[model samples]
Target: MKDAAKASGSKEQTADTTGDEGEAPAAKPKKRKDNKGKDAPHYSVKEPAGYYPILPVQVVPAAERPRVFAYASSTRRDFEVFNRYDLSQDLDFLILEIRQGSHSPFLLVLMYNQDAPDDTQQRGRSFERFKALALPDMPIVIAMDANEHHPLWEREKL
Candidate 1:
């Protein structure tokens, strides 16, 4: 049985090498045509003034793929740490709240961190310990610093 396994392994290796040798070179993907000139067909699309429509985003359902509700404290220390460690992986949405007004909820985005490295391999690890804790899929709101940094205005010589 051991001899047969070794023979099969050798045959598989030889077959893989032969397959590689017989395979054609990969072709480059086709690029889309630039529609910058007047010859390009223009669809009749009108934009409403003062009221912009929210664009639809591709998001996997929570049932199929677990969704994360990530938010930083008012100091944004956690966010900075997460960003530095490149830990925002497998997160369907990244909700960033600009302000915590008297009656304002949070703004969200159904996207992953574009800047993180090895994100594919580190899938769903972004949730970390939070994964164990059960949470609802409701809107997560995080109040942020309205003006964290401001230039001090002092009377000085120009």
Candidate 2:
């Protein structure tokens, strides 16, 4: 995916930060409290220079040719154009590498998981795989469509 998106020939990327959602509101620049005086760039949903924003992918046109990777629960005839890696052929996960002009390359991982609590083990294993592939310095973004109820991303109201 990195080679394809970085190829000089492709001009524009159809997929933008916006995926299914249309234009809704102006995106705010996400800040990290830990990044005090650090050189790490705070990636913007509009034009991410150094990092890849995982969630809230909007469908607007990309500023440039964007690297795209997707994993589907079922094989589809649509995405055959892109190279597919079968490392975990049984798992519904895919990864893409994107590099901006002169910026360090980052990874984007998209995954799907079952909603049942019993499926957490599989999710954990998938995360472990992702961590293994990630570089220490490279930024990573994981986009997941997990319907499970969990406190990690959600908290019950007091």
Candidate 3:
């Protein structure tokens, strides 16, 4: 969403709360502006530490297979691993075939990419690598950031 917003040069949306709740219940939410007077995207400080929140991440997809990370906060186990993939082993995606004995199974994917939408050559990557994972049986969801220039962005400075 941020990428799309930036591409069109519009105000960014965020999930942040300003802690000023005295407004009327039906009032529009406030917008935070950057120093340039343009609305800024919501900032986040959570990553790997649950003390606040999980951050936008830099995935270190395992160099070798059979590596899985999961969180189970409840007694019922609903997510089961089907497979994990890294395009050229580059953190492409993860597939979960969620099968709980009494219910019909479904596929779930948790994915994020820091790649620019068009910087295929930057990481020695291309759409051809992504095609290998396009299962004729399952839908794919992808969201990537494309920053031409931004200080907070983590896309390699090359």
Candidate 4:
């Protein structure tokens, strides 16, 4: 709401701020104390329903080339293409290196590999590329969305 109020380029009026029917009117228009005693802010509604601001998305590369990108509210996230580790370059991979406070930075990898038939060479490229990486000793979060149900990961029956 604060972001919206700032975007609208106007102070939050009483009609825009208060939803309570019994709320008292302020002495001056567009001057209302918020919950924290700060000046209230709001965005004008365009229609009868209300104003619905488009949620911001932060793409890592900020380009059309990157088919895989991270979406988050804040654009301060640490992430990159991270294609160096992917020797084969046959996977849709995006990696995020996050460091919180004094904790060690970790890797957040997102991989999307297409499902290939069993015993075929098409599916092994991504796996081989991942195994070839010389990763550091830190927590790694790998999110893979694939249709592979191999027994190697303890999946005997699919």
Best by lDDT: 4
Tens digit per residue, CA lDDT, model 4, 1-158:
22223344533222223423343422344565656896443322222232322211111111112224343333333432122222222325555555666677677776665543364454554445566767678788888775476566775553
Candidate 2, which ten residues in sequence have the lowest lDDT sum? 56-65
**Poorly placed runs, candidate 1 (over 4 Å):** 1-28, 37-91, 98-119, 125-158
lDDT of 1 by residue, 46-83 (tens): 23443221211112211122233333333332222112
Candidate 2 residue-wise lDDT, 25-91, digit = tens:
2222553332355322223234244333322122222222222334322233323222223222223
**Which parts of model 2 have CA positions greater than 4 angstroms off?**
1-90, 115-125, 128-136, 150-158
TM-score of 3: 0.30
Work out the TM-score per prediction: 0.23, 0.32, 0.30, 0.37
* lDDT rank order: 4, 2, 3, 1
lDDT, candidate 2, equals 0.39
lDDT of 3 by residue, 1-158 (tens): 11222344433222232222242211124655655785433342322432222112222211211122233223335533332222122333334445566766554544433442363443423233444554535444443332245666656754
Candidate 2 lDDT at 73 equals 20
Q: 2 or 3, which is superior by lDDT?
A: 2
Against the reference, the lDDT scores of all candidates come to 0.28, 0.39, 0.34, 0.42
Return the candidate ranking by TM-score, descending. Answer: 4, 2, 3, 1
